[model samples]
Target: MVPRRILLETGLECFRESLNDLHAPATCATHLIGCVTTIFNFPPSTPRSNAEMDVMVKAVEKHYEFLNLAVSFVAVPRTSRQLLKLTTDLAKCDCPMSHPGSTQLHDLGQHWVNDMACKDVTTLLYFLLFVPSAILKGVNKTRVAKGSNKHWPRSISDIVPFGFDALVEALSQWTVVLANPIPLLFLGDALHVCGRPLFTAVTTSPTFMDRLISLLRITCANMRRPQKSEQLPVSYFYIIAVFLFHVMAQRTSQNSIMIWVRGRELELYPILSEAVTITKDPKLWPRTVQRDATGIAMIVNIFHAFAFHFSKDVPRPPGLHPELAPARESPEIEPVIRLYDLLSTRRDECYAPGCMRSLQEVGHAFQKCGACRKVTYCSKACQGADWKNTEYPHKLICRQLQSFIAASGSATGHPKDNFFEDFDQAEAEAVTAPLLAWVKARDAQKELQDLEKSMRGLAKTEKDEGAVEMIPDLRSNS
Candidate 1:
């Protein structure tokens, strides 16, 4: 019965020597894996709180001699599935290679790093970069020699033992296993990344976005409970809302969200209310501190009804829903840049309503909106229709986009990340009108639920309701 502190100190000493000296990388990796497996793996049976458990687990990772210098044990054995989790904590950090003249790291005669001064996640990435490709090749070799003619399963995610940490890493390893020849990562911006046929196959699949939404619903459900039994940390949910806004938050999902959202507003409202409600709970998240998760749960979930996009589209309409846009004194926003200034921005389709023509079909000729200059039109007619059309008219939002452009100029304009970094009162008030509406709807819902519970004469609390097994599935359903 050795003290845990002694084990910790001894392990740290061993880990320091192993990493700094580059002395037997495999042995060190295996040792740390065992340490992490025994000391860090959280079972429901564990006595400690999740916060204390998290602190202990994070203790294994330490800063080395240099400031940004850190390392991770990346020699993953196929059998040890729990150690593969690199979400929540690692996703926020980016890995960049160090300078030219530092001690080069060599593993099996191959240089893994030129210098030691790199972030912990970077070290993980460096080692993991090759391991996945190798594992993939070895798997193929086994299949080939065995004369197995079975094609890769479409439900590859269901069969995979580990949930991949990075989406790129997943694509790299799983795509090879799934036998996709093209690499989608190297393709440039969001437009290019979303456009690839192989990428589209996964994104455009009927079940893809449905699965994503279900998982989000499941997490939100878990958070509503009193206990700390979460499938994922808050950060992952924040990232999902920000990155997948087109699918998750947007109203127009007809052409492509790329798959599921499909403008089903009823299916969206319940989750949004739950997400906002949970983040407001002091028992769940601290009231004094502001979390990006709370901000995200607010910003993205604020009325799915396009409140943020109203500046002034047309003359007074009788029965339009009220929005949180600025007061309507401003004139028509003149376009900022000329035809040469459009910058292509990798857009393939026109921004105007009812314009189905692609860049390819339209001979790559498109004109920029004069006011905001952010939107492009395939022709003058479609642009005109989008501006004045009563239903979801683009005319209302043009000046708002123009204002964003004005605020977000390059070296010439204010920084894009300024007000958004903190997600303060100013930002909250900007969307305050619709957010208030959402709060009212949620209150109404709570009253109805309470009434129903009273009629039933009994109801289990949320804790009891969420006590069922709800392990999160972050794995891509390829």
Candidate 2:
């Protein structure tokens, strides 16, 4: 026996290094397998408590996050498949070579991530910036190529066990992030960067969302039982709810909206509400809301549903759902600017005479302009005035802005004047109202086009006196 303690330490060290420098794939694999085997079969000879195990695992996870970051910036070998296989094999390996938990490594990675919900908007913001940038590409590539329904971790049976309610709660936390404007914007941009065509497979696929929802609900309902060995039950209901809202809010796949909600609610609500209402009359309902594997699974599924949209082969609703169609919210907002607009703006900015010399941009020196005290400027004069006539509107706005602002807390107008007090309360209306806005914008564009066409016809008819007008100019003004 190679001293179980020594083997565990060596394996853990290698696993850490592999995740830290993901480029060293072979080394990572060897270390990961070796460490897991030692832990499972031999158990640390000196013995270790659950807390110590958690510390070690957390250290490894931090390295994993770093690896994900590095991999996002640089290209790597076809490690997705290799990693999947290694993890799968490790899951099945006999004592001293696999993770000790009932759920396999695959299940742990697949589901446990959201077990401890995001603590606050800041963490959610970090998730927005880091997660999509890191995982979208890899997820899309693997999903598109394999057309596998396998989610993150490929198999939840390989890691820590979770239940559905836990899953739903975990996912709900992520939903709260998406509902935040700043994080939502970046995540949406990342989704766009990952592109739509690739996502068709996931959104459109039959049973992907449905199956995931079912799995999460079943898992979450059974979280408290120790007898339920194997699958970590974490209900994915909340995540599913959040996902359905996001996809439907964006008007992506109308097909799955009702099905996902109905199915998940049927499976999850009874259990989740129990967890949610546990605080009601604590004398009567004593169980705290701490969730098990099933609950966590549900949560992961919810986020996974929308996140699946980033992968290829997720189907879209070919046409809007009948109930969702006609006079409802609009689809997602258009790109912030058009290509023509960007080109024109860039050209004008570069060529304009008397343009501000102190505009802050990448590669420019970072400094605060004295006059505005809000906007960044390389020089004092540029910050002092926007124009001689209009006054410094930007400065005034910036002066009133607070540095430590939550996405929801930054309110505009007087409390009495502004109807909406907080972003969270306002999101439902703000997001849904865009549909009406889209319709108005669309109708306006059509009117303009029709007017232009009529004008062109009038011009042509005038040039050719021999021609007779078959149709009258039907401009609204006319």
Candidate 3:
């Protein structure tokens, strides 16, 4: 076998040759200068340093090669757009499945995409931002129909699908590298690209939604703290949590619509509650900050998308009997409309008037009753008295309330391991009667509210409007 020293010298020579061939002379020289500086700056050699020195030397050699490679690629002269495409190809080529040895190559692709997206955005910003007066001159002006609006730069409807593809691919790779959140940043850019003006097609696009939700679910389930009690990286927690919150709120809404139609209230209630919880969390900023914001905006976007689609796209449940169709003609459909309206409105905003303060502070009220966990307040003091006073009346209608929200998603079909399914399992295994009671009570309260609304409307037409209308009269008339 060759002596170890010979092996070391050969390895160093290979590194040097790679630099010579792949890099420009000036670029190569610059790296060599850095390497030389590092070498001389290496402290005086001692007797204790032979093995360590060899390892250190190899590390320095690798750095030299990396610097050389970077310089070489820079000197190769490619437009930002060409470089962007090249980097995308490189990323795909270096995907962990295809080129495991160059897995780090993935990072290079990420960096390139980031640079190009940012640079392109910066160029556009410069034109539109500083020189809004010249916007007409910069563009070849033309009128476009709503259906053909994808061509506009401001709308970015054209780039949305490409952005979706990029996000899906990046997130797919992210399952393998949770600690490096660089890919999520790319997902964010894609999100922004799809979100501007009216790229509703991108979010609603069936092709992209599946992959997006799949990535989100896996990312959330994989989050774990590292061993040795070290603080897990911030990116790990942030990316997973944000993704989970979004998936629970947005994707599930779309998926749950079919469930809602199926009339699976037992399975659907918890999911709707969870969705509300995610949206209600004040710690979550609805707005994205440039640094930690990319994947998050998708949450807000998808929520609105799901709501819009639910309003315009969802068909009335066919299961409703012929007799109920007449009820649809009544103005009392207002409460039912309001309930559907709640699905489309931001939960915080929808629930705001019901409570005196925002849900985060002193939460709307009734948050204190053991039955009121479904209710929330900004603080404990608000919860305390509110619970005692409302508990008895609220208890009567809690189950109906939960059932209505649950119906929002569970009406379609019962999905295994899904939110609806998990809720059923939770109900069966529930160890605490109080917890179950609270769930039941919340649903009941919602039913009472709907009944009250229906009765109140009927009362106006019949007897004393001053007296509360009878539930029996409204039910019999229906």
Candidate 4:
């Protein structure tokens, strides 16, 4: 048997060779992934010194650069438009068993189609999961203090050359891939790995925010449609709800809530309601429900709070159904309500100690600090005065304040584990009762309208038949 040192050396050399080969990118990627996986899962029997382990870790660090190169070689488009086109192509090519002609297709051909459609996305998912672990493997724990920013695990984007725009574009591409449930599970894992940064980037972009919200709305809307409901992946919808929940929690502005609500509280409510329904469905994944419970609750409660907050300024949508309003608020939603109240109240207070300018007094005209966004000033002069002040200068503690707000939003005193330990099925149903009732009432209303229209059409037809019969009699008399 070859010596262990030689084996590791040989593996390292092979990995290096693969990275240098530009022509055979797929081959290189496959080889590099194999080598990196082996290094990460290095066997105990293979004796190695600490120095040797460090060497192996350093070797694996190159994997990120190689991954970006491999992706580039695959010709994955960089621009949003091109990525969208790619997404469309993949979605169209994904053949479900229910699709006509899918059954008759040869197994090999079907497999080829599946691979072609899923290749890039699967590669991306693997990169997201593996690269972070690889980078951390080489990190010196002794040098990094516990609870320090350095000790906190970094995202794949933090290590790689991939920009925020590229990450968002990749996420957009996966939004289309979600049409197929099988690939969507993988996409969810990828999202979990990169979700924090992606959420931050998405919150900053109005266009991306709109696209994501539209995707959620369309997906949930499809779930409500009888013809399309079976084809719809309810699990994917749950994943999206979780994603949206994260986005909503981190959003720096209340306007984000309004933008998402978009006068469609009637439509948005059921989606949250159904998410709660799916969470309790024994046949589905319960962990998804647990993971998403806070977000779902937060959004539903935020909707309620915003409705009350903007009741006067934002005119109620025309023909707003009474059933859409909650019959009664649940105590469980109080935390979210309190959070919103706190946010709204805090925005009115000037960050500067001496200045007294309120958001209520001036409205959205108040200027928020560009960096942390935790502070607002009524004018540039107030902002300048606050920044230059010797006592509690805004510049000194802006990042700390921003961090505090971020932490509060994410934590929210919600227990991550055993989320439903004390909460029973009966209680779950009780909390969701209003939303479920609204959905039922809306659906019933639709069915009633459809029935009435059908009846009206039938009566018109009968009248036309009688008129036709009279026409012949009139002709005979004439």
Candidate 5:
């Protein structure tokens, strides 16, 4: 009945006041939710002017501000007991009221959490930083209490009705929002903050682990360039590799990894192979060749360990049947192999323009570019001439070239037939050879140490047979 613009302005003002106070009343929370719902439910069929859209965006921003404040409130408790009490109170306050098209306060809270996670970078960071610890500590307390006769007055379920579902939804939303490189950079501290709890939760929950693997595949596939000049940053690729390493390291159950590998092999293998090719190409990632190389090595080592340690669990090698050719053949791997072979065969070609001389053929000493060290020349004269040339001036665009190289390192053309044949052998020797050897040595040493410890324990038991017989059972009955 009232003018929509006037109603929106009033709601915004009330929401602003509530946000300004640390201890806002429950009514204020309810009022703010009402305001957000009103704006969202406004007629979609009616077209709006540019100015109206601007106002709508501002309203959405305000809604996020209110949601962020709610997370802060939830994070106020330091200990499990305090968190339990706060959660119980929140659950009570959040119960729905009888009204048309109205959501409960708790439902609103959950919606806000999910919405903030997808839309606001700052809110997402806060959610990652505070929510996981709160949930983990609360769950840990419940676990401890269950072992004793004494019980906690309240459980974590009292606070989070659906348990870790909210957290899972938040993570899923992150995958959707992180489809672009620019937003991936905004993830700044969230990755660091969420790492431990994320590792803990994924290892403990099969559903969480499944969601994380799905997220990884989506992120890797989306990392491709939509345009020639619009490639993702090298750091983004490195971050994905680091996350995969952490997940792999924390896995205690082999079944989960096996399931993931089998189900996701079609999607995951190519991305990984592509990652290896791009990182190894000096011309593609000029300045970051060493760092990218190291990252790729670590990732490959992790995969190698997975394959070596759990060979029985891993799926059978692809490309065994012609009828199933596409399923086994990877588009991402062949281009890399071809590119590597091409570069290896032409190892001595001068990179300088119009110079066809090869260091190997001419027996000339080659000089490397000091800045990128990616390209070589037959002589210093060619290098100087290339740098000074106006048509292809190397100095002006050296840094950009390095960035481009890093961005597109893994972007080879479509997959080739029979690409999977001898793929693992070539990849292991090229990318992960050194690191895999080191990992094997370390694992062997650990096994030897464990054997010695067991031997000593057996010796001690034999020497103290009488004493061991005298010792009473200390195991608890309850």
Candidate 6:
């Protein structure tokens, strides 16, 4: 048998050669990236080492093949675009059941799509969203502060802006989910990071949310009643749960859901309630994430929180069970909306009262408010009107956004786990409750005021001056 060192050297050489193949470098690189990800599943306690760090750095620290590591695929612009191109190309495939590897390829596409969706967002926010990045960014920031300015933190976008922009441009040109859901699986993971712009893209796409929700509904249905031919790929469950947060973010999305729920085109509350049962039973998912208690809770709570949050705005049909609304207030409901409210608008649409035009309809980006830097409008006039509107005015929320950076303790050298997974959501909602209650009450009061004014208009006032003449009417009555 070959020695272990020899085996390592041979594999490394082959990996290097495959990446440079002129015929199909992108395909070769994609497979390599995909397999390592699929094969090496491990829990948090699994041991790891820094040998997997930068190859060049490791080589410098010891004797090794530096040349093989020199031409990183991501460093070259052509290769970067090729990486994304691979996803688009693979999306065209139908993923026949004959080859189970096709499913693995589809899973790898999810990771690629997540990266593509997130690259355009602000790096600071992106770092906080992911679990690992939170730790890394904090350490990196402290180190940077201790060092000189030149040693400051940097991201791929900072060093390779063109490469990054090319990836985003490629993404825009290709409409995902029309052909396959694989590449777009975890795309919504970045929604909270990219915020309003990403939210607008999801809602306006027309087919994206429809297809996602349909798949989700089908997945849940299949889960409820098992059948051979009706079975769907298991990835749909996780992807749908993560991606559907877009529907929970804003009023427009909730309005669309209202239509769906009303027509019985789609329903989520029942499925979410079933999520606990579906995720808990090992016979259901076996050794996957769903089998774990934490995973079960996370999946179920995510659905419940989102559904509960938008419960009032998006109504359920009469006699729908669970009421879809768990409580009058939830940590996930109003505060989450308010904290992320800066990005809660449909960014491509006009924010003014009378005109809710879209960039797609108008074929251009709209003007934005300079003060809060939070909203956009069709024109200066619309912006002015929105700012001056008496009820739910943009002016009120603009400065609040300025004060609301990340969360209460995110940038204050404290961890951001609380803002996301770790925070005690039930307890904290109380603090934001009074403010939230006032906002809702004020909205209801405005609605009530409008109703009263309209009803009063039905009756003539003392100022009614129309005299004309019932004389003609009197003759008719006689």
Clashing pairs in 5: 278-409, 284-405, 331-415
Give the better candidate number (3 or 6) by lDDT: 6
What TM-score does model 4 achieve against the real structure? 0.40
lDDT of each: 0.35, 0.33, 0.32, 0.43, 0.40, 0.41
lDDT of residue 119 for candidate 2: 24
TM-score of every model versus the real structure: 0.36, 0.31, 0.26, 0.40, 0.33, 0.44
The numbered model that scores best in TM-score is: 6
What C-alpha lDDT, on a 0 to 100 scale, does residue 360 get in candidate 2? 13
lDDT of 4 by residue, 1-478 (tens): 4444544454444444543543332222223433434434433222236555555455555454444443332223345565454434433333333322222222323333233333433433343343343344334322221222242232343322355455455556545544332322322333333333444555455455445545656555555454532322444554454344334443445565565445555554554455445434444543232344644444344444444432323544443323224333434443343232223323444556576544433434466789866477878888888987754466655654455444443343324232222222223333344324433443454465566566667667888788322212221332
lDDT string, candidate 5, 349-397, tens digits: 5656677454424544466667755566778888887777645456644
Q: lDDT of candidate 4 vs native?
A: 0.43
Q: Which residue pairs overlap in candidate 6's backbone?
A: none
> What TM-score should be assigned to candidate 3?
0.26
Give Cα distance to truth, residue 322, candidate 5, Å.
Answer: 22
lDDT of 6: 0.41
Higher-TM-score candidate of 1 and 3: 1
TM-score, predicted candidate 6 vs. hidden true structure: 0.44
Candidate 3 lDDT over residue span 190-255, tens digit each: 332222121233344444344444444433333222221212222333543333332223222344
Q: How many residue pairs clash in each candidate?
A: 7, 82, 40, 0, 3, 0
Tell me the spans in candidate 2 whose CA falls farther than 4 Å from its real position.
1-193, 200-235, 241-439, 451-478
- RMSD versus native structure for model 3: 20.4
- Model 2 lDDT per residue over 97-166, tens place: 3433322432322222233232222222333233323333223322322333244322221111132222
Cα lDDT, model 3, residue 288: 28
Rank by TM-score (best first): 6, 4, 1, 5, 2, 3
- Report each candidate's C-alpha RMSD, comma-separated, in the order given: 22.0, 16.2, 20.4, 21.7, 24.0, 13.7
